[model samples]
Target: MPVYHSGFHSYVETEALNGALPKEQNSPQHPNLGLFAEQVNNSAFTAPRSENFKAWQYRIRPSVLHCSEPELITQHLIRDIHHKDSVLTPPTQMRWNAREITEEKVDVISSLVTMVYNSVAAVHLYAANSSMDKSYFYSADGDWLYVLEEGALRFKTEMGIIEASVGEIVVIPRGIRYQIELLEDVARGYICESQQAFYLPERGPIGANGLAEERHFLAPDASFENKEGDFSLYAKFQGQLWKMKIPYSPLDVVAWHGNLYPYKYNLKLFSPVNAVLKDHSDPSIFTVLSAPSLSKGTANIDFVIFPPRWVVAEGTFRPPYYHRNIMSEFMGLIQGQYDAKEEGFLKGCSSLHNPMSAHGPDMDVYTKASNEELKPVRYKDTLAFMFESKEPWQVTNFALNSVLRQKDYLTCWQSLETSFKEVVVEK
Candidate 1:
């Protein structure tokens, strides 16, 4: 089992070796134990104190020793929405069935397929059968938020090791070196890459008690591996993949202290806040994390989840109402059925609603909720999530052409009938 310190973004100082971490100063003329000191800055050097994030690592070898001449690699399935060759579809609703895991052995990096993306964020799905061996990867373009949907994964990072299974998530800051090791025969998951760093959303009127508590987020304790061999380093930079041969393992940090490090949070620990007696609360109430954009209230991306919760709304439709919004939404089913969707939507499946695209309960869900008795009920075993963003997501060429794309998804709402009743009133 891996040990973790409790708290979200708290300053953590951990050392794998005794006296490996420097004391009284971030960097000293001669660091303790002859370890090289290196600092990683995630934000502008002069950013606000609260927003600035940096980490100092005391490692046996500097990161510069882990690099060599880079070679370009082909990752055709991975794409950028703003790329010249990216495809833009009309504003519409779309869904895709779960992709079949390949029988051929592949690692996490080789299995990634971009579903949709914008300038600031991208959504990707991956299914891998083999663990990365003597290989490590880091994304210079953005931080990665991993949502495990099936099987388990062990992330060995420069700072420490984090293991996450289904119903959990891991957030790795951009430029953090890590390698994914499979703990199961097969692993499938969703990845949200965002240029903006994810932060806990502020609780205004709801106060500090409800919704993801700070203590539930866990950061790994210091751990290091002293190994040298023929290793490969992969980097996703400027929307392209690059590779390089390294002579030694990069996960050699013996000690580190900082607020910027990879961390994991179990989704089950999320304390959901919702409507109790009236109508359904906006999905924002279920946000687990938000990546803020330049706009004040808007978000570059909001990772929201609809977990099992009590439904006690009276004299109101129990399911989500029909609506359109400015934010583009990419939704995925982790398990069970989404309340607003009766069929077609299944575990591992995904859907997209571009900006201002009308989407809501399907015809079956609407009809059932319309006549159902209004009583307190518990929604059990259901887990759905959405990657909501301020910018519209453009479909990747591979996603648009995938066999998993459900071409008949729009028909689910076609059966909705016009139930308007006009009554004459006394004038």
Candidate 2:
């Protein structure tokens, strides 16, 4: 659902002024409006099956204004390629309780705790008490996928503004400078970083009607802040954070036109395609966004969600079936209880099941779904999601040692007593 279409050749533009946008063409020289034109390229110019994303910007000033020696700053963020040390041997299941930001004040970068990362992708959790003032950030390595679970975040980006609240998502393409402003006093959420550009997954037989309609996908209108003062530009390059002093704010794009822009979508807007008859459909049906891998038909990262929807399948098991998967799954609960996890999987709870790891319903959920009468049951007050990736997720030291980590997560399945009974047939 997230990968709308190939990003190349599609020009999605939002103009804030009449006649402000250059008409009929891009890369105009010596503009009559006296605005500097710049281009941003997100992909290689000559890649096969190229979804090359390029955006033209008209701003009050060019981005070349800031060039200084960057200072390597330290933070809670951790990045690694193979992540061998983070993966626990025998592959244990892990969980974290809801983390409320009631401690010392922290900003976006300061609050980030990267749970897992490779050369291809990284998973992070954040809870911030303050906004970014006179600061901006850009990641040269990958695009960012943000899923806010607790509070709203106002993102002031180079292209425009995109605000994501609880049950919503925003994707900032790699190299787009943006700063966050917490609408609430505190904000908590998950972040997924991909080394490749993310696109709406191919709908295949589902066609264009369901799952993250491109028409519903909206980009911000051109807006810029003309501020001149001491500023800090933070960049994440080669898996390190660097800070540089600048004299002006980076959020200064007055007008822009291109498919290479940030966009926002509410998770509730997704038209879930479920099994009408007897079995649970593949969770791929719930994918909101996907980053495809080099291998065909497989994803580097699939952003899937379990939103509130109807469950009406006669003479069949309703909950998710127990199984092991090749792709590692990292799941988080944004709101109510997950259908498959009856207890202990509270709001803000996070879990990880590595490749080929067995995971399924808790004892209570299995019992209830098996015996309950079949009816059109509406699963309300719930929004759960997963970052299902092709590669196994390696847990960070922070994730393993955090106070929020649950020590007894493995006990949720301990109550599944052996029910294997041999039935003798009477002739």
Candidate number with greatest TM-score = 1
Tens-digit lDDT track for model 2 on 139-171? 887888899988899888887887778998888
Scanning candidate 1 in windows of ten residues, the lowest lDDT window is 81-90
> C-alpha displacement of 68 in model 1, angstroms?
2.8
- Alpha-carbon local distance difference test for all models: 0.91, 0.82
Candidate 1 — which pairs collide? none
Per-candidate clashes, comma-separated? 0, 6
* Candidate 1 local lDDT, residue 49: 83
Q: TM-scores, in order shown?
A: 0.98, 0.93
* Candidate 2 residue pairs in clash (backbone atoms < 3 Å): 2-200, 2-288, 3-199, 3-200, 3-201, 4-200
